[model samples]
Target: MEGLTVKRAYHQHCGLAAAMDVLGERWTLLLVRELLLGPRRYSELLADLPGLGTNLLADRLRFLVARGVVRQCGVGSAQRYAYELTDTGHGLRPVLLELTRWGLFRPELSTVDTVRPRWAFLAVEALAAGRHAEVDEDYEFRVDGEVFHLSVRAGRAHGGLGPAQPPSVVATTDAGTLLVVCAQPTALTEATHAGRLELTGTDSAVRRCTALLTPS
Candidate 1:
């Protein structure tokens, strides 16, 4: 028999190893997280995800596309390429959410210095489980120059990246302050009063949206 070279696999025949086969590559999951909001241009991903090298990002995108975890699409007439998660990639949401929660609850595992605007998506989804809503309310949250929209309606929650049309409430602040406001009632009140966080809307609307999006 002729000798042949093969890529290494965990070869354990276990589910965990199978999952690692898909996601254990460096930066694979983080790239998935970046695309979770919506399709993203290569430059946008680079800007949002600090410390990732260009070549690595490109390689990971290629790997993901080949695996059918992500797909490439054209953006408008400009013919720019955007990368978006495929259905299988979007399926990693719950898995990533669990990891996010685990990291959030463990103080040593998280640091204040590393906060990012997109993290608010994870926060909203984590705490949205028990939120109650009678009517649809849209909120636009601006954190560190990025905008995210969250809506609550008929006891359900929906959110995505970018601005909301005629948002019921708009809150603007740095990412760090937003995290504080989301997690602490005292900080939320103080931030509102101190102008550290700016929110526009009727008091009731603001209050309701806050209740829905704040982390529990």
Candidate 2:
């Protein structure tokens, strides 16, 4: 707890209050959301989280590291530093997914809101729970020119920012069409037939992936 902050404690002597003592700060949970996919370099996190000032980002990262929620690790051959969640941090996955599900019922995005193709991974993870979670498969998605991949194994989903090598299934679509599919999975077929989505793979793999995305 080297960099722990003394400010902003709820002091209510409750478990939830204690948890919030570390996470209640602004941008903390969103920062955790960014790391939910995997480790990200400082530049990557900054780029992904718009309008989070550098100084504040640095402060929040320090606090998280001190609290054992994140650890600094070297990346690639250059040994550049990247931030990744620790076991305690990974425990927040369910919390994040629940929040994602809850937020899905909110109002649609306005013109001022920003969107990233990678966020589609969160939707998939949230919606796929208990629906084919036991299936092990690799699925690639190409949305709005960016590539992402998801792997499911042992009732868990792991996602990354790039393609899945030798992917079992590949689904390509624009952002709007992808949103529609995530909201109404049955529309996937119609979207494919209408040229809004292009699904490529063997019949079985495609079927498995479709079932995985479709809610039970």
Candidate 3:
């Protein structure tokens, strides 16, 4: 429990207060964000989340597990354990998506020039959710040097870290390019021609896939 910050409960019979009792702790909801994609090892979580101390991350995981929001399970041939969100934990997706949208679009908020590749993965999902489009395809996005897989199906988006089935389209670009492209409509051909984005697949497929990453 080293580095854990214990806050006094509101001691009131209110749903908001009760939620705070569970999720109000620093980095708790951010942990929910990481788990939304799927299960992850303690080491994987620590590596992806910058600025979070090891002790603090472990304490937060324990707290979420005790609250029934996260569960630990065995993974890989090594028989190591990983943490995944419970159903109740997965239900927080929409809440997290809304928050992401607000953070991205709110004019009053300062713009973020740099972002983690995994965070970009979630940003695409949030934008896809807001699109409400009827499309289904698996896309492999190579941002900077990191690879991310994004799938949009039945008007919803789902994805996680690593490669997946051969993608319908593959886009190679940096996080900044993505943010600019999402904010303003940039032709895929132009981006590709400029050498800022390397695109592969049929022109039509590339176009459709690119739409998935654009902000709504």
Q: What is the number of backbone collisions in each predicted candidate, taken in the order shown?
A: 0, 0, 0
Error of 2 at 63 (Å): 1.0
Tens digits of per-residue lDDT for model 2 on 1-216?
555456588889899999999899999999999998778899999998999998889989999998899999998999899999999999998888877755654334557866777676677767665454577888998988988888888777766788998799998887766655666646778788999989899998998888876543
Q: What is the lDDT of residue 125 in candidate 2?
A: 69
TM-scores for every predicted model: 0.80, 0.84, 0.81
Per-residue error for 189 in candidate 1, Å, reads: 2.1
Task: Residues 1-216, candidate 3: write the lDDT tens digits.
Answer: 454456668998999899889888878888899888778899999987878999889888888887799999988899699999999998889889878766665322136433666676676777777777788788888888988887788888777777758898887887765655555444444667888888788888877877766554
Output the better candidate (1/2) by lDDT: 2
Could you report the Cα RMSD, in angstroms, for every candidate shown? 4.2, 2.7, 3.5
| Colliding residue pairs in candidate 1 | none
Ranking by TM-score: 2, 3, 1
For TM-score, the strongest prediction is: 2
Stretches of candidate 1 off by over 4 Å are 1-8, 106-114, 129-135
Off by over 4 Å in 3: 1-6, 12-14, 106-114, 183-193
Error of 3 at 175 (Å): 3.4
